[model samples]
Target: MKVGLGLPISDPPSLLTWARRADAGPFTTMGLLDRIVYDNPEPLITLAAIAAATTRIRVQTEVLLAPLREPVLLAKQCATLDRISGGRLTLGIGVGARPEDYLAVGADYATRGRRVDEMMPVLRRIWSGQPHDDQVGPIGPAPTRVNGPELLFGGFVPAALKRVARWGDGYLSAVPVERTDPLFRMVEKEWGAAGRAGRARLVGQVNVALGPDSVVEDAKQTIGSYYASLAGTYDVHMVTTADQIRTTITGFADLGADEVMLYCWAHDPDQVDRLADLLA
Candidate 1:
């Protein structure tokens, strides 16, 4: 399976350093987490910088909050980044959970999902340049890829699976092992019914913390706690030793995960190197 690294959006200095390291590492792709009016920097902008710095590593928004922005504008931005990245951009999007974020951005939280559904088509239309209201031809100079960047939708529930089946190139699973199997089956069924079976990518998000004398309980207190809050619910968080990391990844590969993005809790540069070594 292809492995990717997630940058720490909470720290700008470390984010840049990690981006460079990930580009040079064995990781097939590098991803940035998204949030607005949060602690992190803007994902697209940071990705643009990484694109300029690296030559081949695919850059992705692990998941961008789509309902908060104008679809056309976001399309333009993503297209521009894809061009700059030489077609290495994968746009992962989802409806954000924070109601305060939507309210702050003057977007209605209640209707964000509906807005996302509508926005997907508009974004595609803009990218394809099929001609729409008040615009002539397709948007230019167009993305580096003819079809524009790959769109990956993220969420763990049935509604999210349905959305992926309806309008996405893949589904991003960000839950624990128990939940993932069911969601993966749901995606497989839905994709087959949609005639997109075996065509859609399946990416699993796993939290990682590896070292000697490091117990699962330690990971639970640190990484697990953070992800639980982010996921907005308490669920099993996969905490394992360095050896177990490889085993878990293999299991996910067996489960049909095309790729696995590691959300590392240790922000130290050394931890990045250590994780790379363990994965290698």
Candidate 2:
């Protein structure tokens, strides 16, 4: 099972330093979260910076809030990022649940799920160099992989899963492996029902804050704030020791996750090396 790093999108000085460190680490991929009502850096633009600084690590958005942005422009920006990243982009998207995020972007919070359903086809149409009309798509430069980045969707809702079956390349679940297994099975059935021939990727996320016990509270607080108003509760696993984290990851691997991205809650870049050493 491949392991990726989910680094925080912080202020320039700190984020750049951490991005560079992650690039040089043993991580196979590096990703970020998105928010409109928060102070977090923009995922696509930050991904562009990461692509310039790294050669091997895949650059991804854990899940970009697709409904908040205009679909065409979002597609253009993502394609450009994919090009810049040398095709190392996995575009995970979702209808962000935060009402404030939708309001901030002037998007219809109630209709976001439906908007996402419409957005996918438009994105794919643009990426495939086939527009429905002159104003709609077939936008200039295409994505690096030809059909845009690896499209993945987040959420376990029935409608969301139907959208995945229709357009997504995989499922990005920010849940534990135990919860992910059944979802993967459902995804498989949905894919087959949708007439899709291939197996969708299952990317698992586990919030981990390793290091001394002192960092646990700080990690929880940071995660809590980041997820404030977005989720009912924020769960940042305080893996106090290397042995504990290793066992946790092995459990995820055993659950058949195609890849697992570890969301690091520490601010320092040295934490990257520490986790790498532990995983080594």
Candidate 3:
């Protein structure tokens, strides 16, 4: 299975460090998460910077909340990032959780699912240089990857899976690392019913913080704080330690994951290096 790292985009100042390290490492992709109401960097802008900082590791929005932004603007930004990265971009889209985030962006949370469905065609048309808003012709410069970056859809529900079958080149499963099988099966079934040929990419994700016991606890606390809204609702293991992380990833790979990205939860930039050590 391929390995990827989720950049702690909140740590903007050290992004270059992480990017260079990622480029120098045994990593397949450097990814970002999307959230409007968080202390995080804008995914596309950060990727543009990383595109300039690194050359080898692919950069991606592990799951950007596409419905929150203006579709045309989103298309341009993604296209530019793809150009800057010389086509090394993977795009994952989803209607995010967190109603407060949609509220912050003035987006209608209730209709985001349908809105995203609408935005897909708009994004594709704009990415292909086709213009809208009464413009004369095509939009900005085309992405290096013909039309745009490869797309993956995130969200585990049946409705979400239907969209995944419709638009995604892959399925970015958001379920916990352990409970991914049922969702992956759903993806396969949907893809087949949609008459899609070839294997759909199965990407698994996990929140992980690795270090000594004390550092581990601190990392777990950080993750807990990040997902506090889900607290007391469901059980989740705040992964810590190299062995645990390895087992988790290997388990996902054994279950047929094409790629697995560990959400590095520790705040320190050194955590990147530590993760490299473990994987090495």
Candidate 4:
């Protein structure tokens, strides 16, 4: 199983530092969380910077809110980033959970899932160097990969699983394997049913922060605040010690995860090295 590190987007300035550290470490990918209304940096743009700074680590949006932006524009941005990253971009997308994120963009919250269904094919079409609108020319800067960046879909719903089989290269899970294992099986069933050759990739994400007392406490506070709105509805999944991190990775690997992204909630760049040392 491969291990990946999630960027601390809460501290924008630390992104490049962390990315470079991850690149120099055993980490295979550097992931980012996405949101429109939050104080965090935009995933794609921040990832572009991270790509420029790091050579080996793949840059990914652990899950970008796909319905918030125009599909054509999103395709262009992702294609451009894929080129900038030397084909090391994984486009993880989903219909986001927060209504405020959609409301801020004037997007319809209720129709997001349906919109995502409609948009996936269009994104593929654009990436195929096909003109999104026949009236306009084909989008330029074609993706490094034949079909665009490897797409990973997120969400626990049946519709989300269907999207993985229909349009994505994999499934990205934020939930634990107890919940995700069944979903992965369903994805495989759907993938085979769809006649997609081979199996869909299974990616997992866990929030982690390892450092001094202050750093761990800070991570707890930051994460708590981020999920404040969802309070009772959301459960914060964070591990603050090296033992927990190792255990989490082993558990996911045993569960058949292709890659596990360790989401760093604290904004300390040195946390990258700390994680690397622990992993080493």
Candidate 5:
């Protein structure tokens, strides 16, 4: 399976440095996460910068909160970014988990799932150069690819999984194999039921913090604080050792993952070479 490196969004100033290092490393793609309520930079804008800075690796949103943005404008931004990146963009989307993020944007948190379902088609329509109803012109600056960028659907709900067959190009799982195995199977089953040819591309995620004890401890605390306010107990698997990383990647490959992103939580750029040497 291919391996991607997820850059840390906590430190915005060092992002390009990390991107530059990752671009020269043994990584296929670079990923970023989204959160409006958090201190992290916006995924799309940051990814645009990363795409411009790097020539080899792809830039992706690990999971952009789709229901929070305006569909037509988002379509335009995505199309522009896709072209700017020379078609090296993958838009992973989901109806987010944090109610605070929705509330901050004045989006109806209760209706997010429905909003995302409605938004997907509108995004495609805009990307196809179709004029909005009663408007004289269509959205300008077409995408690099025929129908905009590749879309990977994220989230653990049944409706979320169904979206893979309905509109997405694949599934993005943020959990480990023990939890993600059945979900991937369900997505494949839905793909077949929906008469989609071939199989759904399955991408997996693993949170990591590979470095000295101080860095690993800081990452654990940061992760805990960031996720402390959620409804239930938030338990994320953060593989710290090189052995753990190897074993985790192997496990995902066994589960038939197309690509597995190492979602590095440590803000240190040195972590890039650390992982590169291990993967090499």
Candidate 6:
């Protein structure tokens, strides 16, 4: 299975350093969390920086809020990033759930799902270079590839799954241990309905921790707040040793996940090294 590293975009200095490190490591892809007003960097800008610094690692926005921005503009930005990255960009999009995020961006949270549905066709049109009165003609100087970046839709709701079937090239799911079967079932159904059963990719994200007592304790202290809200839900973060992580990742692959993005909540750079070793 393809492995990706999820960096904390909230810390620009550390994120940049980690991106460079990950580029030199075994990771095939690097992902950034998208949060406009929260404690995260703007994904496109961060991705652009990563594209400039790395030569091979594919860059991804592991769930950008599509409903908050104008589709055309976002599409243009993604296309530009794809060009810079030599077509190594994957645009992971979702209708954000946080009401405060929507309010902060002056978007109605209730209308986000509908807005995302409306924006997707426009975004795809922009990517495909289809002439549209609403879109910027031809998407600028052209992308590195004929199509723009790969588009992945993320969310757990049935409506979200339907949207993935209708509009996305793949599904990005954060599957809890209990919900894994249902999530894969929905993805399979959607993929079949979209006529993309084998074509569509499945990328799953999981929280991980590795090493001895001090290391584990340190990781918990650093990432505990970030996962505090997801303690019991399907979003429950997993804290496991390196061996456990390898076993779990293998399980995900067995369940048809094409790629698994490891979100290491630990701030230590050594954690990435440990993860790379464990995965190896």
Candidate 5 residue-wise lDDT, 169-226, digit = tens: 9999997767889999999999999999888999999999999998798788877777
TM-score of 5: 0.97
Q: All models: lDDT? A: 0.78, 0.80, 0.82, 0.89, 0.89, 0.77
The TM-score, computed over Cα atoms with residue i paired to residue i, of candidate 2 is 0.93
Model 2, span 125-214: residue lDDT tens: 888889847666458578887777898888878887777788989888887665677877788889999898868787888887776766
Model 1's alpha-carbon lDDT is: 0.78
What TM-score does each of the candidates earn?
0.90, 0.93, 0.93, 0.97, 0.97, 0.91
Q: What is the per-residue lDDT of model 4 for residues 47-131, given as tens digits with 9 covering 90 to 100?
A: 9999999887899988899999998889999999999889999999988789999989899999999999999888888899887
Provide the lDDT at 235 for model 3.
59
Report the C-alpha displacement of residue 118, candidate 3, in angstroms.
0.4
**Candidate 5: which stretches are off by over 4 Å?**
none
List the candidate 3 regions with Cα displacement exceeding 4 Å: 131-136, 233-235
Give the clashing pairs for model 3: 129-138
- Residue 82 C-alpha lDDT in model 1: 92
Candidate 6 vs. true structure, TM-score: 0.91
Error of 1 at 228 (Å): 7.7
User: Hey, what RMSD does candidate 3 come out at?
Assistant: 1.8
Stretches off by above 4 angstroms in model 4 are none
Badly placed stretches (over 4 Å) of model 1 are 134-137, 211-240
**Model 5: lDDT to the true structure:** 0.89
